[model samples]
Target: MVIVLDFGGQYNQLIARRVRECNVYCEVLPYTTSLDRIREIAPKGIIFTGGPASVYAPDAPSIDPGIFSLGIPVLGICYGCQLMTYLLGGTVSKAPVREYGRTEITVSDSSNLFKEVTTNTICWMSHTDYIEKPAAGFTVVASSDSCPIAAIENTERNLYGVQFHPEVVHTPEGTKMLHNFLYRVCNCNGDWVMSSFAEEAVANLKAKIGDKKVLCALSGGVDSSVAAVMISKAVGKQLTCIFVDHGLLRKNEGDEVEEIFTKQFDVNFVRVNAQQRFYDKLAGVCEPEQKRKIIGEEFIRVFEEEAKKIGTVDFLVQGTIYPDVIESGLGKSAVIKSHHNVGGLPDYVDFKEIIEPLRNLFKDEVRKVGLELGIPEKLVFRQPFPGPGLAIRIIGDVTPEKIAILQDADYIYREEIAKAGLDRSIGQYFAVLTNLRSVGVMGDERTYDYTIALRAVTTTDFMTAEFAELPWELLGRISNRIVNEVKHVNRICYDITGKPPATIEWE
Candidate 1:
């Protein structure tokens, strides 16, 4: 296994995901992790994640210099590279020109890190500082036009550093470079698989939850469903799954979720139809973060109320994945958005503890574990849905009227995408009920109604995504059907913005 020392970098989890792709398990630990803890884990290799800090700053994050002499293979990226150089008595200062996107770099093929990577290749660079000189006994293995000493390696010490990021998709051969580091440099066996994770997780959960009642917030989506099944397998009837229908779900989703969990699973299943409870709380709220917090708090309150009827529940479970944690400002990363389960939890909770079994796994990895647990293929491959459900999908204050309109429009959009034989290929597709309204000539009469925005993206990992380019014919059909079939929708717009520019949900 490899351990990624996180220095508040946004891509810390992404680095671990890339390492796991090589069939090697990896975990991300904070930069403040002590040297003794690293030795206790005894990882085959160590990775330093990039952060938004200049190493020379007085308050910049730093590690113990003795970490270099531990005889473990270490790889540093971006800020990590500069920190490594600065700590090793090398020169690191601001570059003449800051590189923030894709750039071409020339590499020394002789270096083990670039074993199969091309000599001249494209890499993603996001740094203001550059390495001016290599440390003693370290060789400059890669360099770009604007920045010198783009990569450094101390062969005898098994240390490597790259000024550019190798975990992002913009770097075409980034995976190959990481694969080489994991197998060639670290000598990892690459024997880890999803099955191993499932077996280990069940055993650990059983030991931790002995003779205790567990309550799961099951949303019937892939993540929550997988978590529920895994917990049931561990404690059997001791686990109770509470499915909350907050009136913000897609068309018929609440009923569909109830039917599956109550009949299929052996655990104690309870469905709470608290539509009016949430509607009253969010009567006039418009801010996205506030809406998330209200809904999240309401969810906990509902669970607490349900737990009282069943006596005492020692633990509360949420289906929180890695993206939820990272997007909600994990470690040092900036908060892209606050996920209900992560950043939106209230200060006080009724449960003795909250357990998130799938917290470290990504969306795709969670699906793999779902399959390993023998969950039905239909449930395992269900589209990813947020814990906040359709509340965030609605742009402004959420009302029952807006919820109905959005659900109808979104169902039509999904139906057409699947009918066009593109549903499985697209990573995520949905519709947003924009607050904006416009005038239109419908049936030869002037009318004003809400506009629905459609979003679809293609991505292997949810971290970064590109807007999907649907054929014009298909897009036209979807737009035409949505306006004609869904009431209160006068216009349809397709969102061409990707993840960086716009999140998948409107709110």
Candidate 2:
């Protein structure tokens, strides 16, 4: 396996994704990890991720230089490139002008890393300090106008460094560079795939939950469904899936979820229709977090009741992924805004253990895993819906009427998104119902009703997202349909803010 030494770069995960795209297995570890610990993994190659900090910083992270002596192939990225230079007695000075965007790199030698890549290629550069001199016994194989030692290679030691990012999609030959590293230098076979991962995960899960009954909370999304299926395959009757329909699902979603679990999979599925219970709990809830908390608490109560009927559930299975846990900062005890399943768990609630089978997988990878599990493509490629569902879509105090109106608006939004042939292209697309209403004259009669805000975001992970750029004609059609057909919504608008400044959901 190739090991990625993470130096706190945002693209660290992208590096891992690129490695996986080459069909080679890779795992990420903190830069502070010791060389001895690295040796235990017996990695075929190592890739150093870029960081935000300068190598010369007083509090910057550093790795033991001894790891390079292990004779394993090493590839250094931007900040990693600077670290390689500093650790190997090379010079890295603060750049006279910082390089931040696209730059052209000229390759002097195309034998190893740049084998299949063009001699002159566009690359993504983000760094303040630049490598000024090559390390001892290292040759400068590539150079750019901004930096002389743009790329370096120690042929004898199989150590390579690139000052620009090759993992990002913007770098055209990034995949080729990774393929060469995994295959040519590291001699690693491209054998890793979703099926193999699923097989290994099943074995590990069975061993971990031996003789223990596990209850999986199915949210009807691809993540939970895939998790439930995997757990069922591992534990069979010992695994029970409890689905709580919070009356926030889209049209026919509850029935669809129940049908898939019971008829198709032959899994023990407990369908609890607690719509009224959830609605009752969220009677006067206006705030998004408050509504999420109420829904989560009600869901737990329903699951708890069902679990009590069964008695003594040893493990609680959640489809929690790394992004969710990382963004929530579960370990740091960051003030978690009730995430229904994850953040909503009460402090007083007790469970013997929690199992997250898909914890290490990303959203797209989750879909791939679902496909490998023989799940229908519809579920695998379904557009992402929020955990709180249309509850968050209803801006004001949630009522059955509000839910109905929002559901209709949301359905229309999805239908139009698909009609525009942008369903698969976009990641998550939904509509939010705002409390404020605008006056409009329909058939010469003045009417005032709720305003529905349309939000569509394209993202690899929900942690960071950018609003989708829908065509003007398509947007107009959606707005017209919602206003003309769906009652209670007098106006429609799109959310343009990104994730940092504003979340995908208006609430």
By TM-score, who's the top model here? 2
TM-scores, in order shown? 0.89, 0.92
Native-to-model Cα distance after best TM-score fit, residue 92 in candidate 2, in Å: 1.8
State how far residue 249 of model 1 sits from its true place (Å). 0.6
For model 2, how does the per-residue alpha-carbon lDDT over 1-507 read when each residue is reduced to its tens digit? 998887877787788878988988887777767788888988999999898888888877788899889999999999888898899999888999988888898986455888878899888888899988778989888888877888888889999999989998678887898798789889998998999999999899989998888888788998899999888888888888888888999977899889878887857888888888878888887888888767666776777777777777788888986555533533222323533463355443445888899887777788888888788887788877777788887877989999888888888998999988899988788888888888988889999988888888898756789888899999999999999889878888888989988977676
180-285 per-residue lDDT for model 1 (tens digits): 9999999999988999999999999999999898988777788888999999889988999888788888898888777666776678999999999999999988
How good is model 1 by TM-score? Answer: 0.89
Model 1's alpha-carbon lDDT is: 0.87
Stretches of candidate 1 exceeding 4 Å from the true structure: 280-294, 324-350, 395-401, 435-449, 458-466, 497-503
User: What lDDT score goes with residue 222 in model 1?
Assistant: 86
